[model samples]
Target chain A: MAENPMEQFEVFKIGPSLLLNGTNVSLTNSSLFMIISVFLIILFFALGTRKLNIIPGKIQVLNELVFDFISKMINDTAGLDAKPYFSFILTLFLFILSLNMVGLFPYSFTVTSQIIVTFALATIIFIGVTIVGFIKNGVGFLKIFVPSGIPVFLLPLIIVIEIISYLSRPISLSVRLFANMLAGHTMLKVFGGFVVALGIYVGWLPLSFSIALIALEILVAFLQAYVFAVLSCIYLNDALHMHH
Target chain B: MKKILVVALFLLSISQGTYAKEGMPQLNPEFWIAQIFWLIITFFLLFFLIQKFFTPKILFTIEQRKNLISNLIKDSEDYKNKISVLENEYNQIITQAKKQAIDESLLLKVELNKRINEKKKKLADQLNIETEKVEKEIDDFKKKTLDNLPEIAGNFSTEIIEKIIGAKPNASNLKAIISEITDQEKKSRYV
Candidate 1:
């Protein structure tokens, strides 16, 4: 009745394929959307800063609201030490949120649904956080793997588990975002197909359901972005403060 | 915008079959390199722009607002303290004025009482002198009137005797006789 729903996930080059050391570095739909998200962020902040109001205009208020939210989140989760990295976390959040929102447009590519993109972002954060830990605590950062109150026999087991979980951070972070975006968009595509298959008279049912799913997907987009940033803050807290 | 959307859809339709033959296009490793490449580029770009351009001004504005609020609170507290001090000074002045007024009124009352008493004593003395003069005058009037009464009676009796006898009687002898008779009457009636 409608085109294959999976066809929407297809990635294709938009321009001439550029071989960078025999690697396909050509721009794709995913890249185009990514660039769009970046420009949108630039445009939004540009508008926010243009007026420079004491009593903020709507855009500036929105800018401040986002800043204050992430600021408070970092402050609450990681304490004062996390304050310095507020802009980085804020940037990460806005980037993901922009990508998510842009993807919701019809016939638009969702960059976040790609596992490699999410994984790459998560890997950068994981590597950065690890380096920070080493910088702050030196060899003592290794103690993050060992349980303090465990018996001697359980130490080895606990250390292995901790190391595994520690290594899994990037995977988990990446998968969480990638999976949520993939599932939501996939469901939307499927329901959109269902509306087409059901004909004009019976199509209203699936159409309404797709509308509802769209609302939920929007919520998920915001939520996943929040989670990604907050988790990063927590990881930083562990690295910087190391309460236990 | 719609043109862009239509173009994008047309592109997707034309290019779909190449990747659509697979199980999952996301799992295909062919396109991962481009996606990750752009992700890194765009992510860092956004991060750089927001950090460089917007944050400092916003933070400065927020900090200034905080300082203004705290200063306003401090000023109000200072004003409250000043008002209390002024109120205390005003209360002290009012109490002092009230005490002075009460003291002045008491002094005025005492002075008025003294003046009234002096006037009362002077008026009583004046009334006593006037009363004494009036008593003396009354005494003189009574003496003069009583003395004249005997002579008047002697003359009246001589006239009575001359009329009865058709001739004048001896005036000196009659006066002496009348005097003796009046004297006896005075002793019996006036004394």
Candidate 2:
């Protein structure tokens, strides 16, 4: 019988834990790696910006690159008033990007590869946008549900449609990233398996394909992170401006 | 919301077994737990670094650039004012120099004319005095010569009369003597 592809994804317990109703809440390999990723990201930025020189060293250069990139993104999409939100947006982008890239390592789990993880991120963004909308506009936040220029008779249906569209922001945002990462990784694993199954001569083809897919996956990882950030900015803009 | 429905439908479609092969990985609870924990940690750390270091430095640099530009602008304005003032002062100096030169030339011309006229008058007065003195001398010589002219003429006439009387005549002498006597008598009577 063929081995179960789902077997590679199982989370095994790694530490002793308190049992609540016979089930133990224990740390898993996935959790351990995630903690490590967080630590590494912290260490990187901490060391990167310690000097804060006018002419940046290698680490500071990288730090400034990220800073300028995110600042520009916010300024462009969200307007100058949104400068305050630059830190949050930049943090989101880096965290998601690092998590995605970390997942590509051998035997490492892609947190973004799972729907739950992406959904949590998307939900947070959704709540944030909603809060900002209400906070900025007060009772006028409902105006975002109904676009201007629709006829009176069609208004009800249009408003419903608009509301539905607005609510789907998180769903779309999360799924786009999650689906891309999951599909790309699965394809890589499949092709990688083919390299072993097919003997040496034909194996080279699948091996090469796997290599190419790996590179493509890395690109997709970065792209998805950027898309997520940009979309968030656009949503924030709608909230701030009450644009339909 | 329509968008939410669309996402639900999309998720529903992808939930099918077609995309999930027999050997494909399944979503487990541990993955979710790890992602949530790491996401929070990473987010806070990133936020702190941005807030503490990056933001302050960028703002400080921007402020410094603004101050530098303002200072340069002020300096340029001060320079322009100084230049204009210098130009005005230079023009004033040139005008004063020209005025002084014209005044000096006019004074010199007037002084020269006065000196020339004075010298001409002095020379005319000296020439008039000399001419008068020479004319007076000539007049004096002429008067003396005129006075002596009668005595010289009397001597010359007496000598001629003596010679004429010696050369000619007895009868005429007698008659002349008689006549002389008569003429003398008559002249005396007449006188």
Candidate 3:
């Protein structure tokens, strides 16, 4: 029988444990997958952009498409002030997307399946966006919770809800990605286990379902990354404009 | 062989230890530090690579292509303007040349007519002057010839008479007769 479906999420130390400042900063399976994603992203971008041309090939087209997609997304969502953060957003999108894809392969570990990784990213964006908001608007940044045209009687209630939503940004962002990756990968493992246990006669059934799930998972992966990046752009837009 | 067996047993126990954990290993606080730490490192590494290298080249290429297109369009527009200006100048030159040619032709016709009329008048005047001189000379020659004709005729008549009769007739009588005959000839012939 195949190992437990949950075993896929285990983080095993791949090398000698190292303690940095009394904390265990040892390299593990999760770290290995993260590094692999980084390498893959570098390889993809490097390979596609190596030869610049007026007319592009297949890979170059894909490279430009991704860049333009995020570029236009930022411009549409966050306007031109978001132009400066194009690199950060592009990196974030590529990193998440590549990590998601790399995890789809057999025997590969999904980095985004871990809550800590996604939460870390989301917290960083959330914190950075808040700082930017405060910097751009000063004390007026708090006015985002106080919407216009509301009756003074409802202002207090509206502000509470708005504040709650604003505070939940990082949690929702992190959980959305982490849950989706974890659930999809777990489901795939569970079904894969079913296929093996059922053997040749009925194996094809679960096997086909898993295959279909993979296709859906791939779409989910790309979508989650897009959602992640777009939401960040929206947050940035709010900070810079303080209105939308 | 004993060492290898012990190592395998140790590895199995370690793997078993993780599987024994409750709920999600993701919720486990133990691995959170390493995962977050590595994620930051790799995320920044990816960010550094892309920001430092990729986007600039792609942006430059795209911007260059856009500039090339816009420049070509601008150049074409400039050339189009130049073409229209040249066409206008050519048309103006043609019209100007045509106007000049018409003016010169009209002027030439006027000058030629003036010269012809002048030549006609000069010829008529010269002809009138020649005719008047010729008529005056004829009148003078007629008067002189008439004046000389009577004397020569009287002398010739006397010589003839002297030869016929052996002497001239009476002189005063001949004078009277010749004078009377000359007067009569002048009146008859001149009148």
Candidate 4:
């Protein structure tokens, strides 16, 4: 049998140990790529807007397209009151999107495929939005757990359910991105193994399937990033407006 | 260049851990803390970089470009309005000038006609006085000639008889004959 397809997700440490409070906080390939993604993002924006000309070049145009897209997404979902959070939302979007795209490369490790990474990100957003909720609405933020127009008999049950769902926000958000990346990449690896093992004689079928899967995976990568950002915006909106 | 340096530094930092470890290291509890540690560092670094530096500059450029476009449009509109106002004012002045010119021409024509009629009336009066004077002079000349006709005829007949018959005719008889002839000529001319 061919090598296991699941082996692609293996995380190996990249650098020597730097003992941080007795934890193995040594740099890993995941961290390397994350840093690389951040670098590329900064480079893209810095160079794109360096000229600042009235008539935009290709890089500036691409930069503007992304800028406008995220801005519009925030404005549409979160309303004008959420304008203060524009930088945070935009940064979150660009970071994840860059990581997702970088992950698509062969022999590369996808950081978002790790549950810890996505959960960390989701948790950050959840905590931040919760803080914002409290700060903006004070005690009234707790009212989100209680549905209006519910019968007194069902109030306790519905509120419990609502709170549970609210708490599960980070898990669902993180798992959604992690699972999609993991499955899509795994399937592609499996198909790649088939192409190699079967050779040229019967490999064409699996090769074609791999091509289709790659295309779909690219789309999923972009879509997952979009879903992540949009959901965060919606959560922030809930906090800002306290809308049910 | 700075971005490339940052990427290179990151690569250098992580280059030491490319060693093969057994099984899926992602599931290994030994690596989770490290992964989370790196995740926090990377996420926040990127977030601050973008938020503080990249986002503001890009949005500023876009906004500046938009403001430029709107200002250009506004300036062109103002110019158009000014041109239209000037054009309307020019047209009004031209119409007023044309109306004034026409009024002046009409007045001049009325004044010239009045002057010509007055001159024509004065000429007619002068001509009537001169014609009356000439008519009275002609009446006096006719009266004086009629009164001298009998004497002038008696003298001329006496002279003519002496010359023709070698004898002078009687003055009174010739006078009577001349008077009778002149009376008959006068009756023929007058009646």
* Interface C-alpha RMSD after superposing true interface residues, each candidate, one decimal: 6.9, 5.1, 9.1, 8.5
Q: DockQ of all candidates, in order?
A: 0.27, 0.14, 0.26, 0.24
lDDT of 3 at B115: 100
DockQ-based class of model 4: acceptable
Off by over 4 Å in 1: B1-20, B105-191
DockQ of 4: 0.24
lDDT of 4 by residue, A1-244 (tens): 3877667777777768778988898898888889999889889987897887778988999988998998899999999998889888888888888999999999888988877788889999999999999999999999999989999999999999999999999988987887787777878888899999999999999999999999998998899999999999999999999767
Candidate 1, A1-244: lDDT as tens digits: 4776667778899988978898888899989999999899889988887877667899988888888999999999999998889999999999999999999999898888887888999999999999999999999999999868889999999999999999999988987888788778878999999998998999999999999999999999999999999999999999997765
lDDT score for candidate 1 against the true structure: 0.86
Model 4 scores a TM of: 0.72
Q: Among the candidates, what TM-score does chain A have in each? A: 0.97, 0.92, 0.94, 0.97
lDDT of each: 0.86, 0.74, 0.87, 0.85
The ten-residue window of minimal lDDT in model 3 chain B covers B1-10
RMSD of 3: 14.0
Using lDDT, rank the candidates from best to worst: 3, 1, 4, 2
Residue A125 displacement in candidate 1 (angstroms): 0.9
Worst ten in a row by lDDT for model 2 chain B: B17-26
Q: Which candidate is the best by DockQ?
A: 1
| lDDT, model 2, position B169 | 38
How high is the lDDT of residue B81 in model 1?
100
Error of 1 at A65 (Å): 1.9
